[model samples]
Target chain A: MAPAVLIEKLQKRYGKVEAVKDVSFQVEPGEIFGLLGPNGAGKTTTIRCICTLATPDAGKIEVSSINAIANPKAARQKLGYVAQEVALDKVLTGRELLQLQAALYHIPGKFAKERIDKMISSLGLQEYADQKTGTYSGGIRKRLDLAAGLLHKPDVLVLDEPTVGLDIESRVVMWDILRQLRDAGTTVLLTSHYLEEVDALASSVAIIDKGVVIAAGTPSELKDRVGGDRITLRIREFCPLEEAEKAKDMLKSFPFVQEAIINVAQGNSLNLVVTPQSDALITIQQALQAAGLPTFGIAQSRPSLDDVYLAATGRTLMDAELAAAGSRDPKAERKQNMK
Target chain B: MSSTVTPSKPNVSLKPEAMQVSPAPGFFGELVQETLALTRRLFIQLQRRPSTLIAGVIQPLIWLVLFGALFQNAPKGLFGDTVNYGQFLAAGVIVFTAFSGALNAGLPVMFDREFGFLNRLLVAPLASRYSIVFASAIFIITLSAIQTSAIIAASAFLGAGWPDPLGLGLISLILLLLVLGVTALSLGLAFALPGHIELIAVIFVTNLPLLFASTALAPLSFMPRWLQMIATLNPLSYAIEPIRYLYLNSDWALNSVVMQAPWGAVTLGGALLVLLVLDVVAFFIIQPLLRRTFA
Candidate 1:
């Protein structure tokens, strides 16, 4: 009856770094909820707090009506966490690792064996199940890690960056498994920086930036929030700032073109928001031709999650990723995650 | 597609599950199950990669053989009326081997922590987190037993006579007590320290110093006043002296005076009591560290 997971006003600080600050979201039962953010945006920290791996400085995290903070043991029993890093012991075989996981979640020996076998087969790890995980490829390791996380079939499954470093095939597999888990009545929560991963898989998304939730809605609802068709137009492949400004001003003059901004990080490209008009692209091309400006490239489509993010944060997700990457302290982050 | 049939619904409520899993076992039952499983994993690792075990036994045998021979030509009364140094050195070697092996018990756990393997264990619905520590203790104590056996076997072959059955059993008891204490500290260090490199540094600085200061290689009389004070205070000394006394005299009693520390003579019973106290103190000291980590 309570939401599968309710994290209200969550705050976590690691020494001087406020890893997660003032985050709130509710995940409905049997739904796949995505916490979408860039690196160092506190998604993992938030997951850690929810899964009871790290204590939140302040928050209410209830997993299936259990208070995760006040009663971590009971909450942990109801939650399965697949950490961002695949934390399998290299020496352990896939089956052995799952067995260990089953026991930790207190799956009785008889039931554990049955579940382990079924999970290994369902996860497509039968061939590698008995082999030491050290010999596994990245994809295989991720599969095993997923199986281990799901062995207990917790009511709420929490995953942190489930496919950050995985290959395309593996990523697709991971997504499929997540959907299957949801269809089978498991409430799934995942954090990721990949827009498409979230857009394609997550039923609803919470966009977080700098440890704050800037937006929360279904993927299409978020896409609809910006309320216009997106037009990304590049002049001369790399337009000059003045030319980009001129193009922005020209585009803004049209009644249909409600908003225009120059994307400085993308070679001074012009990003526009226009009311849905069938010939918006053609009209833009004609305007460029009449102005004697060469149109290097142009495309138009419905606003995506990136546009939603940009509208709310004043920058694209890629831009935020680059900025966050530059200022990140890997050493300190490692220490925080290790804790 | 079967998967794409369900579109993203912004306001749709998720229906509860039609079928739920059967409930888990009671707390203590689950705790025992998990602990045994974790301990079994450690043993399986040891079984597959027997290098640590092989090296553990071999290193002490080397010390017993080579180090015992190093002083084979010492004066007859040099090691206190023992016909040979091997006889006197057996207890020290056995206790020191157990101590050294126990000191490194935290390495596996430290590696687990460093590589994020410990995070896997931590996130589980473990009944008690201390089961992690308990599993490590069980593994390390088993290893100490194996290594102790190897050392004792090698010494007996080198003309260091074996103690009577009761003496042999007492030797095991003393080593078990010592191992429990040291293993607790090592596991505490595993959690308290940042990484394996620092843990190894602590172990490197600690291993030999504790041995040297504990009358492992030489008797208490061989040390200067300050060194004697340190060696007397060392817990390893308590274990080593009791076992050494048992080996020397077939007629040993629990109250037999084994060594005369700077303070006074400590009987065999007194030595065992000291080791027991050391075990208690070591565990007491590490409780807070474990709490901070497992919290």
Candidate 2:
């Protein structure tokens, strides 16, 4: 069977800015695939192209073997898109908005009514159904938006930054709902910059940056490819640079230690990458004790998705996000997204 | 409470053979549905928060009563031969109300665009995006009709004479044509302009000037040569004159003369034709612009 969604070599540009370039990924049936990137990394553009909201300058995007660009209407029938922003008409009640959504998707009248009720109940929106959306809280509004997207039960559901700006409880609720959706045989594709969000929910992920797909694999697979356990060691609570360097040099002599760098930003602590071994932390402690260095703190863990991003891009996601934020022109970006 | 029974296997309803769900072909029917749905949304909004509609109706009624009184003391024949100044001013108020209402048709759509609500409609499987344009047109025209009726009723209550039966029908027809044309132009700008602020700025600058320049406030014959030329060329003048003539002459026919343009005399039939042509031209001009943003 063909994948639920197939995008190959997608390219999109907003004037001189290449929003998406040379991006390709496939989402398997009954799986949650994530596009992980910083804010300006073109994940939204890629999803927009797949949903046929914006025309791509070049690329092949398909939904259930139907070409999205050539037969957008058919592809649209097979795909449900929940945009980043919840664009509900404030004047419309939650139930009324769902009814409108049902009509737009051409659901059969009887089935539409049943499905709408089911969605409203399942999403815990029954009490708010008759109230205008303007009166809804952010979480309630997002739940309604999700209900509207799922009214047609398309084969694949695409979400952009699904949990952004939500309170912790709402985010947890959204995650549980997404898991239920995946278990019920719906394919899910989502874009998110939150590391923990993708790490926890996505079965597989593609890390995109500067409009290009830099890495793609299962979460564990990508993490394993980076191949190291991280250890942060501080000789003193706030060590001098020279003492941190001495500790780093001594730690580098260990056979399991692959690399060591002093993190001056954290008061001259040493961050070390060690080959995964049971006694690596013990070995580092021994070395520090021999040097008459008092161990202020020490911790060790397997590499995380952030490490995967850091290894691939040579910069942390946070750094890249700040850089991208400073360079973005809000006015131009708003214009590009308007249509 | 009803968790008593567990079956041998999870109950899975036999799926009906997947019904072929597809959008209708061609843009017309889909456009109709979307337009109707959008227009229905506007009416629902009006039904719930009717402050704008209330203001629209009340403002004109006040203008008809108060402004008419301000001119009540003027010479009787100074405005026209047999028509009172109040009667002459009634047609201008009616035309002005419709024009102003139609001019504002873009405001809601522009707000939708600015607030990101438009993206919701665009992402749907719309057969043609032109449904957005059609919806705005329908909503604006319906609103113009409501405002026009209120103004007409208020003017009549203020002792301004009512038009004959045929004249009333003609008045509605003219209002429809004029509203259609102006609504098209306004909706076009809603798509072309960057934001609601820019669109509202344009509307503000153009609104009162167009009203003053047209025959809505004063007849072309009463204006200076330059002002008369400008008023004659204004499309609002074309709408106002025919309705004004119907109010002033009970026996008026299609061939009855409404105004003398700089170059020629415009009859009632000629003015109606001009409005029809203007509607066609306005839609034609906006076709490419709408296609660019919508398609």
Candidate 3:
């Protein structure tokens, strides 16, 4: 069978902003595929193109071998999209909202009733199903949005930042539900900026930056490709720049330490990439003591998805997020999403 | 865990044909279902709030009682022969109320667009996106019908005599045509304008000017040449003249002259034709705007 969704050479521009430039990815059936990126990195734009909400300047989008660009109506039938923002009419009850969704998808009346009941129950929204959605908490609202997206049982379920604003408990619950969705033969695709969220839930991921796919692989595979044990050391809670530089210089002399740098954004903490399985944390602590510098905090672990992002993009995701946030135009972005 | 076990149909496949084993409804059936579903939501909103409806009904009555009294002491033969100002103003109130209500049709749609709720409707597998337009038109026209009835009842109670059954029918037909065209333009504005603030601005600038330019508060003869020319050119005038003619004469015919315009006398049949042409022109003007988004 063809990939559940295939987007090749996707390119979209809003006036001068090239939101998605040469993005390509294929999501296999029944897998939780994550598109990892920072804000303004074109993840939502890519999702919009896939869900047929926005037309691309250039690309081939296919759902189950059906060309989404050429035959959008047919492709839309196979795709279910849960946008980043949970949009529900405040006046409409949760059940009424789902009923509207079901009718829009053209599900038969009797079948729609059965499916709506099942969705409400599965999402644990039974108690609140008949209440106005305006009374729902943020978590409950997101759950209702998820239920609406899944009401039709589309072949591929696409979500954009599914857990952006949820608390820790709600985020974990959403993760579990998404996993269950994948196991039940639904092809799940989600975009997220959270490293652990993608690491814990997504089976495979594509890391995008500034509209380009910088890296794509399983989380572990990308981490393995980054290939090192990471050691983060801080001599003080707010380490001085000189102290961090001293630690970085002392750590880089060790044969096992492959690279070292001071992260200026995080209190001038020293980050060291050491050879795998090396007892780098203890050795670094000892060396710091011998050098008369305090070891306020230190950690050693295998490379994570963040390491993959940093290795490919030369900056942490948080730093990229801050940079993107500073330059974003909220008014322009709202205009882009309006249609 | 038991709930998680749901939705696991083993027949999941990537091929399109496999998913189509159960036949879906035809296009028109699906369109009707979706349109009704949307229309139902609007009615539910109206039911719960009822504020807009209450205000819509009350405002027209205020216009009838207060504005009618404003000119109550006018000399006879001011508006027309055998017609009092109260009787003459009922048609204007009916037409103006419906026209303003239809003009505000874009507000809800504009809110929907701004709040991203429209994106939900757009992403669905709709048989045709024009159903969105159809649903809005249906709701606005329905509200117009209710408000029109309220105005008619209030006018008859206030000594503005009721039209005959056929005249009532023609009044409704005129209101329906006017609402359809105005609703189309309002919905088109909802899609074309960037935000609700801009849509409201357009509506504010439009509402009163059109009312004044038409024969809503005065006859064509009461205006100067420039104003009379504009009144004759206004579509609201076309709708108002025929309904006003119906209220004045119990035995009204289509070909009877309803108003003497600056240029010439316009018959009731000619007025209906003008409204129809206005409807056609309004739809044509908004076709490109709707196509950009809906297509």
Give the whole-model CA lDDT for all candidates, comma-separated: 0.87, 0.84, 0.89
Q: For candidate 3, what's the TM-score of chain A, rounded to 2 decimals?
A: 0.96
Name the candidate, 1 or 3, with the larger DockQ value: 3
Question: Which lDDT value does model 1 have at A241?
Answer: 97
CAPRI-style quality class for the chain A–B interface of candidate 1: acceptable
Answer with 1 or 2, whichever has the higher lDDT: 1
> Which residue pairs collide, candidate 3?
none
Tens-place lDDT digits, model 3, residues A1-339: 779999899999999999999899999998999999889999999999998899999989999889999988998888888989888999999999999999999988888898788888887888779999999877778888988998888899999999999876677778878887887788999999999889999999999999999999898899889998888888999998988887888788899999988888789988888897656677888999999999889998889888899989998899899999999999999999997
Q: After superposition, how far is residue A309 of candidate 2 from its true place, in Å?
A: 1.7
lDDT of 2 by residue, B161-271 (tens): 788988999999999999998888888888899988898898899888998998876667789999989999898989889998888789888898898988799999999
- The lowest-lDDT stretch of 10 consecutive residues in candidate 1 chain B is B5-14
Pick the TM-score winner: 3
The numbered model that scores best in DockQ is: 3
- With candidate 1 superimposed using the best TM-score fit, by how many Å does residue A122's alpha carbon deviate from the native? 0.8
Per-residue lDDT over A1-339 for candidate 1, one digit per residue giving the tens place of the 0 to 100 score: 779999999999998989888899999998999999889899999998988889999989999999999999888878888888888888889898888898888776777787788777777777788999998877778778878877776789898999988777667777877887787788999999999989999999999999999999999899887789989999978889999888888888999998888878789998888999899999999999899899999999899998888989988899899999899999888887774
lDDT of 3 by residue, B1-295 (tens): 1233332222222223232334767999999999999999999999988898889889989999999999989998898853689988999999988998999998898888888999999999899998988999999999989998999999999988888998899999999989988998999899999999999999999988999899989988789999999999989999998999898888888889998897999999999888888889889999999888877
TM-score of each: 0.94, 0.94, 0.96
